[model samples]
Target: MLGLMQDWPLRLHRLIDHAARHHGARPIVSRSVEGPVHRTDYAAIHRRSLALAQRLAREGVKPGDRVATMAWNTWRHIEAWYGITGAGAIYHTLNPRLFPDQIAWILNHAESRLMFCDLSFLKLLEGLAPKLPHILRFIVLTGPETMPETSLPGAVDYESWLAEADGDFEWVAGEENAAAGLCYTSGTTGEPKGVLYSHRSNVIHALACNAPDMLGLSATDRVMPVVPMFHANGWCLPFIAPLSGASLVLPGPKLDGESLQSLMQAEGVTFTAAVPTVWLGLLQYLEASSAPLSTLKRVVIGGSACPRALTAAFERRGVHVVHAWGMTETSPIGTICGVKPEVAGRDAEGTLDLQETQGFPPFTVDMRIVGDDGAEKPWDGTTFGNLQVRGPTVTRGYFKAERDALTPDGWFETGDVATIDPAGYMHITDRTKDVIKSGGEWISSIELENLAMGHPDVAEAAVVAARHPKWDERPLLVVVPKAGREVSRDSLLAHLAPQVAKWWLPDDVVVVAEIPHTATGKILKTKLREQFAGYFGVP
Candidate 1:
């Protein structure tokens, strides 16, 4: 039976339109890369986006063409997203932190016709311009005065280019499921694969993110995304903020603790989201400064396992911490760990233990864990297995791949080993390849890493499986001490011994000046494993 409805297409442009019409005066603040803080409103963003769309059409960008942006999380970058999508083009975001070869490969593979980059990446673009023959033009995300001289062909400043046309054209209308954005994986395992996002999926994901159980954003709230736009469309905050009429604060190139704290304090930011490393820096800064988080209310931490100590530090300051878990394939928001009423009834320590788990999924997503035999594992909180997910926002396959990236039963393999409690809370144990098998029992590297991060003297920590003659493979702990504080192997071992099984304790502890990390800020355990390949005297 067909139902009568308006049949409005779920397009990305409509999000900006709704915001402009209903919350036109809402602020979109930015710490501009050009050495000053800039501010604008949703109405101005909508109008400029439309103008940029018209300019793109004049420049011969057709529907389905890919346009790339290697910029930070600023107002201009946000405008480019709406503008490119409004012109029916795919907005491909390139992470500037990635190596030049990887960036060139991604650009060539995507066949990006044009690129909108921040001034900071001009030299990078110039170096890769030869390899990126498909990119016809380079639009620097800056004004004419601040635009630096570049040798790349057909380059221009974004503000000047956007001024070429009036915002009189309407957004292109078509199938809601058409591709609107592209984000590549961090490629820790292999060559990076693209996760193509559709307008329909993104719109649905925004609604889920704005829900109370998720980010719980509202018009009165002011939000900041320390994560960059290149990371899963800034974890969909570019859409989530406007859709909820929440004012946004975009921190430019400066992500250090002092800069972020200053911006948040100045903007009266009430909500923010980033990885644990970011918060760790901020917490350390607060510990030294004794700064009061006067207006900050909540924070969402993800991208890796957040230590419970970090959560306690925020809660101690009256700031709520929401531990979330997701990847590029799931539109980057699979599960959020907000406390449930039933779990809230427990003691404070017990509740913090539950919060340590990546919380349950929103109604749109479904999750399950499977064993090596391809059978479903019981959600008893103790048994861990391969995590799989199926949802509208989840990717069924990688872009341009010949085969589906899913199981025969149609669930996307998350590449993470996890356990789900009977109450529906999901906890990540470790990556499938990183989990240690010692004496026929599995040991969780993530668990040990998180515990190590709880130590006051530890700045960063990682656990890797080391080859052992006795157990075949045993856990090895490597840590980086906080500045000005010295950490010892014995002290770290003693701190961890009381919390976990004796066998789960690391065989040895090594202190290092620093740990290598992936472009996305995750610990590069692959490199660590290679560095300590024979740590247990096994050759």
Candidate 2:
């Protein structure tokens, strides 16, 4: 016997409606791409989103149609999301950092009918316009004055476009599972594949991430999403913040240490989320300037492994660091490193160790590990295997792909090797292709990279396998030292020798002025492997 509940559908428009009614006056601040700040609230956003939705309908957007957005984490972009999705159209966000060829490929592949772009990216769009014939119109995310002259067809200013329509509009209703947004991977290995997000999936993901053990966000908190909207929907904070009625301070395109520091203090930001690299820069800046994290209370670190040293630095200053883990396929929020009640009796070190691992899976997600012979592995805390997951928010297949990328038993292979403790805490060891194999022993490059980062002189480190005559593959260390500081290979090796297993020691250490990174700030190990493929081969 099933109890009946409200037949109301879970959609994106309701989040803004609830926020506007309850938290109408809460501040939503943004440093506009035009070199000024813009401020609005839930009520204004709700009214403007309705106007924008009407405009979208007038522009011929229909249900299931794809409308792309190439803008930063600003007020306008946030409005576009609710407006586009509310009008029964999928909002496709394009990452301008990608190669022009890649941009054209995705635009054509998605068949985006209309694109909302920032003024900063007009030149890129102009150059890419001729190739993306699928895109019917381009709306620059600017006013008439700031709008640059372009050769594209039907180009118009954002303000003028929205002004053409009145704010009298209601959202178009549909099934809960209708596609509302489209995000693609960074295309590190091959052509980027799209992950289509649904209204139900995204709404459920936002609720799960808001649980006490997860983000723990409340209406009283102020959030700063340093992660770009192009990166997995800014880890879904754009949705989570509104649902929780939290004030937001978007940092526009300036994510440097100093710029972020100013926003954190000026806005009284209680919580923020960003990649490990961003926090590293902030910590370095704070150390150099001797400034305290005045108003910032907690930080959620993801995109890559959060190094121990980085967390340790923040812990010293009373700022809590939450190591988050997710992928584009998981609606970008799978696990958050929150301390469990079972860990209460453990010593401080024991608690810290558990907190360092990627925390337990949220209630909505399911996780398991499998071995090469197609068997589930034990959650013994030490047994590492291929990680697989399935949930309402996880993608079952890629967009437009001919086949599903899942195991026969219906689990999506995460391509990551990990271990889960008896208490259900998961720890990522390495990617399947990144784990170094030497003399029948498996070595985790991620572990070594973290260890190397502990060195005072080592600013960034990446561990890749190099061919060796004796051992089939040996670890090679690529180091990027802190600016103006000299790094010595021998000293770094000595520093790491006692920390890790002797066999895991790097074969050699070489310094590079800078390291290559993907658009999402992950170390591009693929490029590094190709560049250093013959380090051992060389005489």
Candidate 3:
């Protein structure tokens, strides 16, 4: 017999409606491309989103259709997201940093019916519009007065459409399992596969993030998510903020050190999240300018491992640093490494060490590690294995039934090799694809990369396998030094002497001007493999 419970449907529209009805005056600020700030509130967003939904429905968009957006982290983009999904259409976010061909491929593959793009991407859209046969309309997210004339003949202004519509459209009632959003993976190995998110999954993920032990969001918190909205729904902050009634500050395209710092200071932001690369820049700016990070309290770093030094630097300044881990398929938040209550009073260094792990799985997630032999390992922190997970927020399968993406047992393989301690904390060693194999022994490239990043002169580092005549394959170090800093091969290798095992040490270190990255800010190891494929060992 089922226990009686509230007949609540996890709908995306309810998030916006809740915010509008309860916290209408909360600020939603965004930086514009024209070097100015535009501010609004939950009330305005709700009204505009309703108008957008009505416009979409009037334009022949129906349930189960796909509406794509290739825009920055701005208010308009957020409206389009909720509006399209609220109208019972799937909201597909296209990463603008992807190659034009990849963008065209995703749009056509998703069979997007309409696209809303930023005005700054006019030229790029014009170049790619001809190839996107499925896209029938191109709506520029700009006002009629400022909309630039482009070669695309059928383009329309966003403000004009909103003005011509009414904010009285009712949210279409769809099943909780119905697809709400589609995000494609960066496709390091093959063509990018689509991860379809449902309204139930997205809403549940937002509620899970609101827990104090997790993201600890509140109405008083001013959040600045430097992660782009196109990237896993900005780690789901767009949905979480509205659900929690927190004030949001979107940095838009200006994610540079100085600009972000200024916005943080001006807006009195208390919590923020971004990749480690962004924090590195902000730390550099703070050090050089002697600027005080006055209002900032916590920083959540993901997309890559947070270097120990970076975490320590922020903690030294009295700021809490949380190292989270997840992928597009996990609705982006599987684990958040915050200090447990029992260890709250521990020594500073010990607590910092705990913060470096990916932390325990979030409330809605369940994690397990399986060895190469398919044996389940104990949470001893030493037994490294393939990480597999199942949760309410995790995607069961890709859009349109991609059978190979899911396992027969129903667990999603995260492609990460990791360890979980008895205390329930998880630590990722490396991606299965990036793990180095020498004489059948696995070497963690992520560990080596993190160790290399500890060196003072090393700005960033990536580790990939280089071919070896005797061992078959060994680790290769690709280093990018800080500006105007010099680090010799000997000094760099010497720094790693005491940190990692001798076998894990790189055979050679190659300094590069910059490391290539994927659209989601991950190191492009595939590119590294291609560039040094033949650099095995000398005869």
- What lDDT would candidate 1 get against the real structure? 0.92
Candidate 1 scores a C-alpha RMSD against the true structure in Å of: 0.8
Instruction: Kindly indicate the candidate among 1 and 2 with the higher TM-score.
Output: 1
What candidate 2 gets wrong by more than 4 Å, as runs, is 345-351
Indicate the TM-score of model 2.
0.98
Residue pairs with backbone atoms closer than 3 Å in model 1 (clashes)? none
Best by TM-score: 1
Q: Please identify which of the two predictions, 1 or 2, would achieve the higher lDDT against the true structure.
A: 1
TM-scores, all models, native as reference: 0.99, 0.98, 0.97
lDDT of 1 at 395: 96
Candidate number with greatest lDDT: 1
For candidate 2, write residues 1-539 as lDDT tens digits.
Answer: 86698798999998999999999999999999998889999899999999999999998889999999999999999999999999999999888889889889988899999999998898888888889888888898889889878987799999999999998988999999999999989898889999999999999999999999999898999999999999997799999999999999999988889888877888899999999889889888887888657888889999888888888888778788898889999999888888877766767567567766898778789999899887999998999899999999999999999998889999999998999988788999899999898988999999889888888988999999887777888899999999878889899999999988889999899899988998889999998988887788842
Judge candidate 2 against the unseen true structure and give its global Cα lDDT, from 0 to 1.
0.90
Q: Tell me the deviation in Å of residue 420 in model 3.
A: 0.8
User: Candidate 3 — which residues are off by over 4 angstroms?
Assistant: 1-6, 402-404, 536-539
Q: Please, what is the whole-model Cα lDDT of each candidate in the order they appear?
A: 0.92, 0.90, 0.88
Can you write out model 1's per-residue Cα lDDT over 1-539, one digit (the tens) per residue?
88898899999999999999999999999999987999999999999999999999999999999999999999999999999999999999999888888999898989999999998988888999988889899999998999889987799999889888999999988789999999999777778999999999999999987788888899999999999989877989999999999999999998888889999999999999988888999989988898767899999999999898898889989898899999999998999987777677877788789879999998679999999989999989999999999999999998899998989999999989999998889999999999999999999999999899999999999999999999999999999999999999999999999999999999899999999988988899999999998999997
